[model samples]
Target: MVEFTYVVSSIIFGSLFGMMAIGLTLTYITTKVPNFAYGSFVTVGLYTSYSLYRFEAITPYLSAPIAFGIGGLTSILMYLGILRPLARRGSPLVSLMIATLAIDIAFVGIFGTYANYLRYTYVFIDSLNFTEILGDFSIFGSQGLILAAPLTLALITIGLYLLLTRTKFGVAMRASVENPSLARVLGIDVEKVYVFAWFLAGGLAAMSGSYYTLYSQGGIATGSGLIVEIFAASVLGGLSSLYGAAIGGVIIGAGENLLTGGGISVFGNGVLDYQKGIPLVLMILTLLVFPQGLASLPWIRVVTRIRRISGRLLGGIRRLSARGLRRC
Candidate 1:
């Protein structure tokens, strides 16, 4: 029973984390910048929702967009108004990284200074029934968010994949990621692509944050250390692949929950609170084993990429072959 509860809890939380991580993965994939401020974006999102909630004029679902938009707009403003301009002036990568960190600090200060700020409480929905993976296992209300958020994430993932592969804008974004200089030569608006990436990242992150508030009645900076957790999941998912990051978030959530549930005498048999270290440990282990990530494994992700690329290359060759055959 104990094991069943732990595993169930892990899966629910893990999936939710994955949803929260999608934008982080996207931003990192395109920008090649680990944007430590990503968590702050989440903070922006939650506060955005909370702000609307205060007015008694909005519902949770509606407030979600309000939060998401605030985070997204802030990101757009930063990229268009600040970061892009600085980088255009020939700023180094290290400088850019530091600038992002500084922005986060300033953002947090602003959040703290607010008179009636968003505070996502850790405890909410004390009990709720959910689709259990096993027998008769129940979950907390927050656990429901764990499930719902990931479903939203899956939709977002499909949407993003379409944007990256099917849409012209997505291709341009991918081209920018591959080589911004070359992409610019090919007539891609590299600046716009980057700005779009920032907005998307911030907007999605905010959705996650607001969703977090729904799970926990948040009014404080519950997102302070979120970057580290996101980073660890990103490492697990595959630093270079968005899909990998999402997967990593799920695994991190599950593993941490399972490990801490055992009360294995770590931190003097502390209850699940020590689960916080699971992501860190999984991160170190993952880096040591599959530095490219689980998504890079032959059985799942890497092989598929190889096949897709191969199919495209061979299709062109086959077309030429048929043309020559007809001419001959």
Candidate 2:
């Protein structure tokens, strides 16, 4: 029962990881650049929840939608104020990534300062810890995150699929992602698509962060600290594919909880302290062995082969049936 509980807990964490990574994947697909500042945006969500609770005495769970809106607004502003201008000037991808890194660095100081101010000004409020709020809500001998994380993941995944496949805006966004110049020629506002893409990415990250605080201890430094694992999951999912990123997030999540979190260590004992290194190792191994990521693995190849064979067989059957009808 204990081991099963541990596995269940890992799955919950994995679902949250998938949620965050899917956002990163969306931004990468549209912009062709990995936003290093993404982690900072998540940190913003954490602080937003913290502030709501401290100032209004509202539960952190209620602050989630607000956090998402704040994150989306922040992303749009960053795109309009910084990234857009830089892109218009034909800034290189490397430079844009570095700019995001700079944003992350700047946000670190900003969050830290705000946290300090909250602590000093409101001595009664414990701004750093909100585990108590999470404790208030429980179901089926489990915490809220066990339901919240997976439910959020399912909704976002389905929403994204529908948006990308059914809606006109989604079609335009996909076109812009595939070829911005061609999309512009087709009378699509590629720039607007880029802005929307960033907004979705930021909003997803913030939502994930809000759910994260329910399961884990959170502070100003929390999101920044998890950036590595987030990046690893994104890369593992093939950065280009949202579905792949989601799967990658879950794998990395389970690995962290099961291996390094000391549920059942493959590296003998005392692995708890080394939990931080799991992401780095996974990232390195992924780059070395499967440069294209898990999406391009042997199972994918097998599926492709099966699809091709089935298509060929169906075509052959159609041709024979058509010939038989002609003879009649």
Candidate 3:
């Protein structure tokens, strides 16, 4: 039963992580920057839900749309007020990256201030846990999050697929990302596409964070603390591929949870202390071995090799069978 719980937890965590990674990848695709402030956008959503819960008794699930709107607005502000202006001024990529880092630091201060205000205005714990408030149900003896998280991820994936493949704006966004100068020459509003990209990224991040509050203990620094894992998942997936980011996030999340649990069971509780290191290790190993990431692998070539080998083996077996028949 404990193991079953662990499995459920891992799946839920993986789904959430995948959602975050997809957002991160979207920002990277549009801006060509790591967007160190990405996690802060997540916190923006977390606190949005937190505030609603504290002030209005609203559930996080119900507050997701509000969180998405606020988070998207915040992201747009960052891009327009900061990144866009700097980019227009011909700032270097490193400068843009540093700007995002600075924004992240600034957000920490902002979130800290907000948290302090909430503490003073209302009596509540520093760490927000909505497990009881969320009222998660059991489906086939498993926790509701086990179903909800993955279902949310699937819906997001399908929505994104339809948007990118079916919509005119999506085509323009893709073209802009692929070649901004060409897109501009073709009369596409590259800047508009970028703004929308950042908005979507922020919205997705916040929505995931809102959901996260249902299962995890969240605080002002919760999103900041998760930044490393989010980056690890993105890098492991191949920063260029959104689909890869999703797969990478799931792998990282599941690997971290299951391996940490196994280590604790085998080596005792002391192993729990190193749980955070799992994602870092995964990131480092991925960089060393598959620098282009799992998405860039030669999967088609691998499949062809396997098919050729199987064909040869089958031919050899048929020849041996014919020899045996002749002898008979």
Candidate 4:
């Protein structure tokens, strides 16, 4: 039963990790720059949840929308006020990535200051480094997040798929992603598409952060700590593919949780401290072994060969069955 709980927890955590990473992947696809401030958006969402709970005493469920809105608005502002201007002036991808880092640092400082203010003035939270203010609640003999995280991930994945495949705005966004100059020539407002993509990315990151508060300790360093894991997941998944990001997040999540939750049985208690390094190790390994990601692994050719063989065997079996039936 304990081991089972670990599996469930890992799955939920992985789902949330994926949720945060998809936005990073999206921004990378559209702008060709990884937004290092992406995790800061998650930090904003975490604080948004904290503020809502402190002021209104509401559950995270109620605060999610507000968190998402604030996150999206902040992301849009970052793009329009900073990134857009720099990009227009022909800033390189490295410069844009550096700008995101600056944004992350500035945001972290602001978050820390706000946390201190709340602690000093309202006495709401005792420590910005760690807080278990709203402890986890259960549902159906499992943690509420066991249900919420997977459901949220599924909905977001499906919604994004539908939006990208079915909607006009989504089509325009896809066009912009593929070729901004051509999209513009075709009368697509590439800048607007970029803005909307950033909004969605920010909103998703924030929503993931809100869920993170339910399971982990909330603090100023929360986002900073998570950024490494988020990047690991993104890089593992094939940085250019959103679905790959989701898969990468789940893999890292499960590995991290599985190790931390049950490593004492397998490798003894000393492994706990090493748990934080799991994602970093995975990131390095992924880069070394499959720099193009699992999606582009060389074994894909072998798999395709096996699939074709199986397909031919199935067709042969059907043909033999039909021949026997005709003979009968």
Candidate 5:
């Protein structure tokens, strides 16, 4: 049987990764720019949950809603206060990307200050490892996270699917993303859609971060540390497809955990230090092999090619058998 810890770890990480990737993809689709500071929104959620836990003795899970709200507000501020204004001035895509990078750099200092404040006020370490503080119940000799994490991800996925496919707002959001000018002509509030998209993106990222704090150590630099993995997942899944992003995040997350765990078992604990490189390598491979990403692959053509090859091999083998029988 697979180790229970590995299973739980994979599920938690995959679910959180998927959530973050979806958020990143959402903003990218809406604004056509990758938000480098998106990771900071995650840190906002982490701190929000941590603060609530420390001050009110509330659980991180319970504080997720607060984290979502704060994260959404922060994202809105970034879009309205910086990105929108720059966009109005007709900033180039590179400039907009650099702007996000600047926001990320600013967040490092901002979060660092917050961490220092927490240390001075609470008289406790700002770095968090919730392994001891958060209690878990056993299910089939495994931790509850195995169930909770994946279930949460599933529900969120379903909710998003319904919202995007069934709701009028979702239709408007899609129209806005497809063509803001046309959406405006159709009397849709394109700007409103963009604002909501950013808000939703940040909210999802923060919620994921709240969940992340339960299993991993979180600190001021946690968001910075995770940004690369988030980008990898988004790129691997195809930035244009939210569902693809979700799938990519889960694959990367699970692959990273399982491969790292296997490496550690064979190569000792030193291998753990290289865990981050797994996602980076995967991202590089994806870009080189499938620039358009997994979602854009022609699956029908691929399956047909596979069947053709199999048929050819089978025919060759039968011909060889008939020749052997005739010789006998």
Candidate 6:
């Protein structure tokens, strides 16, 4: 029963964290920035939503859409206004790195300038009471939102997969990702593709941020505080693979909870405090071991091998027939 409770906790944490992991992967894979702005995106959503809740005559649920929109748009604007220009100017990688750092600092300044330093303040949360939605496990209110995160992420995955795999725009964006020069040669608008990718990632990040605030209610101080862990989850799953990042997040979330349970011991310390680091440690270990990620685990490899063999055999048969027809 305790294990069951942990699993629930894992799911809730995993789902929210999974969203962040995906956002990080999207930006990194799509733009190659190795973003730290994502943490700020999380903070902005929390403080922004809390401010709206405090000032405006709106309910938590009602303000959700506004919070989500603000979070998404704000991030997108930053990339467009700041990062994109730097890239266009043929900035070197180190220069771009410094430019991104400047953007992050500018973000902090903007927070104080606009948010009236509320970005630095913390909000106290009441004991979460949600015995109904998740059964008798009795978790926090935010946990419910966290638990629902997976559904949101799943919808996003389906939508994005279709967009990239099934739609023209998606195909163009992927071409931009794989080989931008060739894509441009093929008459695809590379800049537009990049802009759309930024929007997609920004929107996802913003939703993740809003969901995180709803769950933690820790306000700005702890909002998006799990960034390090999110990075770890992405790495553990293989930063290049979206599905790997998602599943990796869930497994890490659950494993952290599991290790904190009965009879668990590490470094002769309590598992609770060290739970956050489990993902980090696993990330490091996984990178060192299966750097390609569990995406290429033994079972996956076996299936791929069979497919390769079948393709080769089929190609041989086709070639033989073509050669015979040409001779005739």
Error of 6 at 66 (Å): 2.7
- Order candidates by TM-score, high to low: 5, 3, 4, 2, 1, 6
Could you give candidate 5's per-residue lDDT for residues 140-194 as a string of tens digits?
6776667777888888889889998999999998889888899999999999998
Question: Which ten-residue region of model 4 has the weakest summed lDDT?
Answer: 126-135
What are the models' TM-scores? 0.76, 0.86, 0.90, 0.88, 0.91, 0.75
Tens digits of per-residue lDDT, candidate 1, 1-328, equal 2465676667655765676567777777766666877788887866666555554635445677777788889878877776778877988989889988988888777777552222333222211111111111124633455456667778877888898899999889989988989999999999788778888888887887776665544433555577777778888888777777778888787777777766654444556555677787787888899888777777867679889999999999999999999999
Name the regions of candidate 2 deviating beyond 4 angstroms.
Answer: 1-5, 128-132, 261-269, 298-300, 303-328
The digit string of per-residue lDDT tens for model 6 on 131-185 reads 1111111236334554466787787778778987999888887888889899999
Estimate the TM-score for candidate 6: 0.75
Evaluated with TM-score, which candidate comes out highest?
5
Model 2 over residues 57-166: C-alpha lDDT tens digits?
66657788898998888888887888778987999989999998888888888887887788888873466544534433787777767777788888889998999899
Q: In candidate 4, how many Å is residue 228 off?
A: 1.0
Candidate 4 or 1, higher lDDT: 4
The residue-by-residue lDDT of candidate 4 on 208-277, one tens digit each, is 8888777777887688778999999999988877888888888888889897777856877797789879
Report lDDT (CA) for all predictions.
Answer: 0.71, 0.81, 0.87, 0.85, 0.86, 0.67
Report the error of model 4 at residue 310, Å.
12
Task: Give lDDT for model 2.
Answer: 0.81
Worst 10 residues of 5 by lDDT: 126-135
Superposed by TM-score, candidate 1 places the C-alpha of residue 155 at a distance from the truth, in angstroms, of 0.8
Root-mean-square deviation of Cα positions for candidate 6 versus the true structure, in angstroms: 10.8
Task: Give the lDDT of residue 77 in candidate 3.
Answer: 96
Clashes of 4: 0
Model 5, runs deviating above 4 Å: 1-4, 127-133, 307-328
Candidate 3: which stretches are off by over 4 Å?
125-134, 305-328
